[model samples]
Target: MRLLSFVAVFLFSFSLAEVGFAEENGSSVSEERLTPEELDYLVNEVGNTQEESEDLPVEVSRRLIEEEAQVIDSGSGFMVIYDPEVTKPGQISTFASIAATTLKLGGTVYKVKSDRSKDDKFYIYGNFQWLKTPSYTLVDKMTIGFPSSSGLYLPTSGGKVKQHQHRYSQDQQGNGRWIDYTIKYSPSNWEPSAGVAGSYDIRASTSKTKHKGYIGQYVYVPTSKNGKINIKITYGHRRIAGTPSVSVYPAGLSITPTTATDTRSYALTLSY
Candidate 1:
C-alpha cells in the first residue's frame, strides 16, 4: 500500500551541484520544476564546497598548475618534482620545490637571484635545511661548503637522546683523522612497537629498528654565501639507532635568495 517519491533530474552526475538535491531538507529540494539557473547554482555550490577550497580565481588557478617543471644544474644534474599543482614559472611554491631537490642531490653550494623573483616564497630556490640523522656531520674542509651529507634519519621519540647521528667518514684509508669537529656514537634502549607508513611503504610498514625515543631533526640554520650547508660523510655505518639499516629522507622546503631572480634558485634540503 505504499508509493514511491521521485525527482526528475535524479540522474544527474554525483558532483557538488547534485549533492543538496539528494537530501530532503536541503535548500535546493525543489517543490517546483528546477530552472537552469537553479541547476547551475547547485553546481556552483558543489564547487564552493570542495576540500581543495583555497578557492582561488580560475585565472589565478591557471597560473598555479605546473607541468614538467625542470631545474637544470649546469653541473650535469637536474632535479624534478611532478604535480598538477604548479601553475606558472616564477611561482614561490614551485621555486621552493626546486631548491629542496637540489640540496638533496648534493648541490649544497648555490646562489639566489632575488631580482628574478616575483612571488612570496623564494623566487629561484635557495632554502637549505641540513639533515639531523645519525650519519650527519659537518666537516670543515679548508673550503666553506656543505659537507656531502645524506638527508635520512632514524630519530628517537623520547628522552635526552632526541636526535642522534652515527654514520661518519673515517680517516682517509686508515690515517685516523676525525672528519667533523666532534663525533659521537650512542644507542637507544627504547624500541618502537610500530613502524611509520612512509612514501616508500604503504601498509603496516614497521621499522626493524622502531622509533620510540629519539627523533631525527631537519633544523640546520644556513649562514653562508653560495649557500653551502655542509655535511660530513664517513666511510662505514656508525650507530645512532641500534641497527644501521634504517634510512632517512629530507623533510622541508625554504627560501635562499638567488642572483637576478630568474637566473638562480632557492636550494633547501634536510631530514628529521
Candidate 2:
C-alpha cells in the first residue's frame, strides 16, 4: 500500500508539469476556456515571474552618472564641480570641489598726504592672482601706467616716460603695446576717493597658447598733487614658478626693479 501511495503522488506532480508545458507550447486548451486547474497554474506562474524581477539588481550606466554629476561655473571667474552617487532611496551622498586654479584680483589703491610737494605719491594696493591658469605663461609681456593727462609719473619718469608706467617682457623680448591684444574690464565695488580703482582683463593670441588675466589693484593717479588719471598695465609670469611679477621703480629713478615676491598677494603703500 505504501508503494502504491508514492506512485500516485509522483504521477500527480508529473501531470501538473505536463499541463503547464502544454499551455506554454500552444496546446489547444485555450480554444474554449481555461479549466480551474489551468487558471490556478497561470496565476501562480505570473506571481513568481513578478517576484523574480523585483529581486534582480538594477543596472546603471557610467555615462549617465557622469552626465548627472556636472561642473557649475560661478560666472565670477570661478568654478565648482559636483559629483553624486546614489545607492538607494534616502542613501545618497554628493562630492563637491573648487577648481585647482581660478582668476581673482582684489586690493586697494589710493593716495596719502606727503611732507613735500614733489613727494605727493600714489599707491598700488591689493591682492592679485592668476591662480593655476596657463595664461601666466602664454602672456609674453605686461605693462602698468597712468594716462598722459594724469600727470602722475613712475619714479623713473624720463623724457620718454610721459606718465607713470611699468612694463615686463618675457625672454627679454621688450615691452608690448596695449593695442595689440583684446581687453576686458569689469565693474568693481571698490571705490576709492583719492584714486581710481577698477578691474581689467587682458588677453593675447600670439602662438599656439592662449593667455588671459585680470589687473588686481590699479590706481589711475593713485595720488595727486594735481591731475585726473587712469592706469593701464600688464604682468609677466615667472619662468620657474609660473607666478605673476610686476616691475616698479621706487626711488624715482629710470631703472625698473622686479618685485621682491611671487604673484601672491602684497600691500602697496604710497607716502608723501
Candidate 3:
C-alpha cells in the first residue's frame, strides 16, 4: 500500500503559546480541556482507517500536547500523542487517537483486535526518520540494546524472516492441565531507527490434554519501507481432542525512545 502524507494546518493562538511555555518550564498548565466538538472530531479522525493519511492540523496537534496527552515521540519535528483519558480505568474511549496521530505524523499503524474476551490486543506504528539507532548486546538469554548516535546500523525497510517457537513439552500422561505462560518475543531483524527498536512481551493461558496441547510460534518478517516490521503468531491445540481449534494472529508490540537529554525513557504502547 502507498503510504499517505498529511499537511498540518497553521492555527496557533497566543493562549496556546502560554501552554507550550508552561510545559517547557515544568509548570501546571490550565485545565482548559478539549471541547466536546473538538474531542469528537479527534476521535473520528483517529478512528477512520481510510483517512489515516496525513498529519493533523498544527493547531490540533499543539492542543493535544497542551492538554497533557501522553507524548510518544517528540524528537522528530512531528510529535505523536496518545489520548490520556483512555489510560484511566473505567474510562470508555477509542484507540484510534494514537493510530490517527501516528498516521498524521507520517507512519503506518497495524492492529490485531480479537474476539476473545481475554485476548491481548496489539498495534504497531512505524515512521521513517533519520535519527540515532541502538545496538544489541546479548548477555545470557536476555539481550539489551541501548540507542546512541554511534551505536549500530540504521534500520532498513525490511527485517529477517525467522520464527520463534514456544511449546509445552511435558508428557501429558493421559491427563488434562491448565497452564499459564508468559513469553518474551524479540524480533531478530529489528534494528534501532533513530534510537528505537520494536519488541513484544505476551502473556496468555491455554488448556492442555493428552490428545491436545499448546503449541505456538511467532513469525517475524521485514516489509517495505512503509511497513517496517511484520509479526504473526499461531497458537492452539496440537492435536484434535474434540474439534481442537487454533488461533493465528498478530502479537502486541511496543517501541521505546530516549529523550534528547537521554535522562528519560518514553515507551509507546501500540496495543489497545
C-alpha root-mean-square deviation, each candidate: 23.5, 32.8, 24.0
lDDT of each: 0.22, 0.30, 0.25
Write down the TM-score of every candidate: 0.15, 0.26, 0.20
Clashes of 2: 9
lDDT score for residue 253 of model 1: 19
Across 28-106, the per-residue lDDT of candidate 2 in tens digits comes to 1222333444334323432212322221111111211222311111012232111122235776443433223443333
Compared with the true structure, what per-residue lDDT tens digits does model 3 show for residues 24-138?
A: 4323323344455555544453442223222232233334324333322222133332312223677665654333121011232223222234332222232221111111101
| Candidate structures ordered by lDDT, highest first | 2, 3, 1
lDDT of 1 at 68: 14
Over the stretch 1-272, how does candidate 1's per-residue lDDT look in tens digits? 12222243343444545554333221221123334453343235322222122211222122222211122221112233221232367755543343221111222211222221321111111111112121212121110112223222223445432332222122222232222212222322212211111000101111121110111121222232123332221111111212122222231111111221111122333221
Name the best candidate (by TM-score). 2
Query: Can you tell me which runs of candidate 2 are displaced by over 4 Å?
Result: 1-101, 113-115, 135-141, 157-227, 233-272
Q: Which is superior by TM-score, 2 or 3? A: 2
**In candidate 3, which residue pairs get closer than 3 Å at backbone N, Cα or C atoms, i.e. clash?**
6-54, 6-55, 54-104, 55-104, 131-194, 132-194, 132-195, 159-222
Which parts of model 1 are misplaced by more than 4 Å?
A: 1-154, 157-163, 166-181, 184-272
Segments in model 3 whose C-alpha atoms lie over 4 Å from true places: 1-23, 48-224, 228-272
